[model samples]
Target: MAIETTSFESRGERCAATWYLPDAVGERWPCVVLANGFSGTRDWILPDFCRRFAAAGIAALAFDYRHLGESGGAPRQIVDVGEQRADLLAALAHARRDPRIDPRRVALWGTSLGGSHALTVAADDPDLAALILNMPAIDALSGANVEEKRKRAGVSRARTVAITLRLVGAALRDLSRAARRADPLYLGVYGEPGEAFFTDPELAPRFRRVAEGSPTWQNRVAARFLLGAPRYRSGTFERVKAPILICLAEHDLEVSADFIRAKAKGAARVDIRTYPVGHFDLYHGDAFEQVAADQVAFLRAHLGPR
Candidate 1:
């Protein structure tokens, strides 16, 4: 199998992507359109799953949302949930147009926030053959107390202060732009304790590892996303008519299984699997293998032969 670097347009901006193709030749393959979590890039651990999908005789297209990673968008490092969904739709169109892909069997797979987008897209796109979601952050407005735990995560005071000041500056800059209906402020995608983009200690090491030395990975996002997240709901899981596989982390501190189930109750066909691992753990090691196997089986069952 060979991985090809690629790009496609979304709302006139280029969205960078990678295409993983299986060895099967002359046959149009069933493809999976993969989108990454919250401010995540295609290169950040997603290649592992995409490789597995290719190994299972499927093609996988993992893409970065506009304004993030290698995508072409101004006022970078922001996560507008709506824009990300639109980017996925654009990627779907790109996949459909590819001669190597079987548009009728194209599937959608996403993780974390990207999972939310996958469900949202599947809700409206009846042509999709299957859907796979991992630890989906279904409700952007999930007013959880996890922030307190993130605040308590240990980080050097000097670094924290520096990041905090930078966030404040970015916020001010964004405010000025917004007054004229210009671009919003940019903030770090993740930071240590007492800083904006903060994640808990349990998740920080993994995030930092995924971010290290990645050419397309940026440590920033639009600060105004904070204001819109609470109102951004991806509860369309119920509206999805495709066969859906939802993987939940048993010890997930971010998204609750109960909440996910509540939203998915109305789905015509849903299979919920619980992994005895944390949210970030499924991106690697044994947990990833388990989930990837299940996903391949599900996709093969739903999408059929390559």
Candidate 2:
């Protein structure tokens, strides 16, 4: 049950991570570089899941994105998809070179934005063995639009576009300010008082936890992410070459079916499992523990002999 833990420098960043590997495993172990949630840090969650993967005899690497958690970057909680994807690549490279890992069997287990990036990355890397997307944030704009699908939400699409563009501009302005190490949250961390994604029921508790624990939740995402997201998902659904496993939360206001199926068009294989739970349920509670077991079984059946 005791796996080795360590820290390393990657991507010109100081990355804090843990390596979970069971004793008596084969010489070349398959490794997984777990990507954290979009607005969350690795410390806030994933350590438990990392342990589960380790007990399954899979070496797992859990790390913070550059601007979050123990990783090095500032305007400390900024979100940049392009840079984080690069960080994922750097983490993968580090995992592949790990002495206890097998490069040929590298897999990605990503949550939220990390999940989508994992899918997009694996799409181009045909050597990737498999992918596990846990309540992934496939497309922010699309997921945000799903609410409109049911309740009209009384929102104007043009207004959405305009405000989003304004936010993006604000984010750009912050980046410029950050060049001189100025405080980015001149207005406050979150976009609006209650207009953010987690303002809904399914995500409120998790959002509260973020407020209590990370202190970074007050950090705002670069508005540019909204613009780049649609482009990143371009051809993503159909270009993936690896087998896919999607863990959907029935009450997950975030992970939408339309998002995953749309991007998985070219994936060699796909499996979708939905649980009667909320977005945060996958991390804790008896339900998630069992889900973890199922995930291990799935990984064992498809990615390993253990």
Candidate 3:
């Protein structure tokens, strides 16, 4: 296997990427473009998956979204949904343009929020060979009801209300800063309930454990992004024509499995797999091994030599 450092332009910004290529003799090998989750860098937990794909005779391209990691963007750590989708598309284009990659056999692999971006991008580009989504944050695609979210998260109505108010305040502050051309307010990516954007108590430790060796991963994001999150819904699943593999974490506190199932019901070529673990579990330990193996098998079956 060989690894190459690369960069791609997205909306005038340079997005950093790494290509993991297999050592096989194929003139043009199948490729998989990978995007990281919210606040996740290209170096975080993604290298493991990329290595596995390369070992299976598939090429993997992992990139950092603009405004995060090594990518070029002003007012760093902001998570703009539209910008992220565009970045993924840019990565896809980069992979397709590479001489060593088979454009017709290029696929997309994403986890968490990245998965949702991949889904939306694949919906527009039907010619993609396949797609792999692991514990995708599809709830963002539909603007999941606040009450239902509170109930599922086991948080009281009052606590949920407080959290919303806090988010609004932070968003307003950041917007005001943007208007004044000042620094933006930041919010932690993981924290205890009602403390941060991702209010899962266990996420902090799990994220730390998974991102231990990664120096580029940041724990904060611009607060204003939360203001537009509710309106960030996408209705492109039904339009995606490529074969898709959806891996769900049954006990995920961030995104409910039922929400993903209901949204994916209309997609024609989807294979769903549910694992008895939390959202972060799939990034480490035995769960990671099992899920990664399943994904490799899926990729081989769909993107194998043709």
Candidate with top TM-score is 3
Top candidate, metric lDDT:
3
* Cα lDDT tens digits for candidate 3, 163-278: 88888898899999999989989988877554467765546577677457788888788888877662324466788899999999887767778888877888889999999997
**What ordering of candidates by lDDT runs from best to worst?**
3, 1, 2
Please give the CA lDDT of all the candidate structures: 0.81, 0.70, 0.85
Measured over all alpha carbons after superposition, the RMSD of each candidate to the real structure, in angstroms, is: 4.0, 3.4, 2.1
| Candidate with the larger TM-score of 2 and 3 | 3
**TM-score against native, each model:** 0.87, 0.83, 0.93
Off by over 4 Å in 1: 143-176, 181-184, 230-235
State residue 81's C-alpha deviation in candidate 3, in Å: 0.5
| Per-residue alpha-carbon lDDT of candidate 1 for residues 100-152, written as tens digits (9 for 90 to 100) | 89999999998988987887888899899999988887675452325334345
Q: Rank candidates, TM-score, best first.
A: 3, 1, 2
Tally clashing residue pairs in candidate 2.
5
What does the lDDT come to for candidate 3?
0.85
Error of 3 at 25 (Å): 2.1
In model 3, what are the clashing residue pairs, if there are any? Answer: none
The Cα error of candidate 1 at residue 244, in Å, is 0.3
